[model samples]
Target chain A: MKIAEIVKTLDGSVILGKENLEKDVEMGFASDLMSDVLTLQTSNILLITGLSNVQTIRTAEMADITCIVMVRNKKVTSEIIDLANENNIVIIECCYSMFKTCGLLFQAGLKPVY
Target chain B: MHFQYSIEGGDFSRAGNASSQLKKLLKQLNVDSQLIKRIVVALYEGEVNIVAHAHRGTIDVDIEPDKVFIRLSDEGPGIPDIKQAMKEGYSTASQKVREMGFGAGMGLPNMLKNADKLNIESEPGKGTIVELTTLLR
Candidate 1:
């Protein structure tokens, strides 16, 4: 599914990467653990994480995850948005819990990264 | 090309600086995308290892036509048992590190899995060194 559809499905707001709204996301990986995120080899992957920190952005950068869905209404700081923009990653903010966000995306045909 | 970067222990915000730089360099050198991805992931994990566990550290990168070598050495309370530390899901990181979504003990395992070759040496009460090699061609 494209990032735009995922946003619509999850009622998420785009915080950055307006250009990436049409980019297609092939898989989803949800984790609060940065280590787990780094272990996977993927392309066009979406990272669903509630870990609100600069390291979350760093982890996504290292892992080449294209889009991030911040769950549980996690605050997206300016530093985080700046870093994401620098890395060319798209950040989406959602109020749903992690499970609900994943379920919604899965119902919309997003595959798992694993 | 040879490059060196200094890592400040406990500085989580700056953990991936070296990895990002090396990634750009590798891309400019036209390293294979798969190889570059693996190398960067392993290097980033090594970088975070120092930031999360060490006092301070240094990273050395030596790139050859066939392979790239990286060494990370840190000064800190070293791991007393290398075998135990290498195990997945074992971590010594403090609560703060865990709260940042790390300290899950998958760092070394990811490095080992991603790098073409991996070597680790540590001295108890002193520090540790990690060496990783990845082929570029």
Candidate 2:
């Protein structure tokens, strides 16, 4: 799925990397734990997480994850946005819970990394 | 090429800086994407381990034609039981660290899984040293 389609499905707003809306995402992984994210072997995955921190962006960058959807209306600071932009990672903000966000994306044909 | 990064313990904000820099360096060096990913994951975990447990540390990286080697040595409360610490679900991270989406006992194991070779040595009250190597092929 493309990042733009994920935004439409989840009613999310692009907080950064708008130019990357057409980027292809092969899978999705939802986790608040950066450790678990590191364990994933897949690339080009969309990270659906509620944890808003610099490590979240850092983890995505190291894992080659290009997009992130922050669920539960989590507050995203400018610092986080700056880091995401520096790494060319798309950040999306959505008001749905993590479970709902994952469900919506999965329903739209995005498979899990498991 | 050789690179060194200093890590201040308890500085969660700057945890993965070294890993990020190393990733960029490896990319510029034209290392294979898969090898770069593994190196990044292992190195990032090592960085986090220091930030979560040690007082401070330094990461020494050596990038060569055939492989990349990383050594992370920290001055902090070292792991007493290497065997237990190497367990897939064993971690000694503080509650605060765990709340920040880490400390799920997967860091070291993840590093081991990604690195072609991993060596860990520690002294109970002194510190710990983790050495990781990955082949570029």
Candidate 3:
């Protein structure tokens, strides 16, 4: 699925890297733990997390995650956005909780890789 | 290319600066993305451990043509049980560290996973040294 589609589905705002919205994503991983995301490697993955911190961006960069979806109405700080922009990562803020965001995306065909 | 960074404890905001700079350096060197990712993950976790657990420490990164070596040395309350600390979901970090989205007890295991080789030596109540290496190929 294209990130543009995911944004439309979630009615999310692109806080950064909006031009890369058309990038393709194969799967989604929802976790706040950075190590979990690192251990479970997947290509072209979108990471959904509630924890908004520098480590979140660092984890995304380490795993080469295409985009990050901040659920539970978490605000992406300037530092986070700056880091994301530097790493060429796309950020999306969604009002839906983590579960609902993942559910909607999964129902929309972006299944998790177990 | 080689790099060295001093990590100060209790500074959550500056925790991953070393990893960030190394990531940029690796990219500029045109290192393989996979290899770079492994090196970054391992280095970042190690750096965070120093800042969270130790009073202070230093990270030495040796970037070679075929491998990257990262050594972290810290002066703090050393691990009494290396085997237990190596286990996932086991941590000695305080509650304040846990609230920062870290201290999930996954730091050591995650570092091991990312590095091709890991060597840990610690003296309880003295200090600890962790060395990690990742092969480019």
Best by lDDT: 2
Any residue pairs clashing in model 2, and if so which?
A: none
Cα deviation at A110, candidate 3, in Å, is 0.8
Residues B51-104, candidate 2: write the lDDT tens digits: 999999999999889889999999999999998998988877889898888998
Model 1: residue B21 alpha-carbon error in angstroms = 0.8
TM-score: the better of candidates 2 and 3 = 2
Q: Is candidate 2 or candidate 3 better by lDDT?
A: 2
Model 2 bad stretches (over 4 Å):
none
Q: Which candidate achieves the best DockQ against the true structure?
A: 2
Candidate 1 lDDT tens digits, A1-114: 999999999989998998989999889999998888888888669999999889999888888888999999998899899888899999999999999999999989999976
Model 1 Cα lDDT, one tens digit per residue, B14-81 = 88999999988988988887888899999999998899999999999999999999999999998898
Model 2, TM vs. native: 0.98
CA displacement after TM-score superposition, residue B132 of candidate 3 (Å): 0.6
lDDT of 2 at B30: 83
The per-candidate TM-score of the B chain, in the order shown, comes to: 0.97, 0.98, 0.97
Candidate 1 to truth, TM: 0.98
Residue-pair clashes per prediction, in order, are: 0, 0, 0
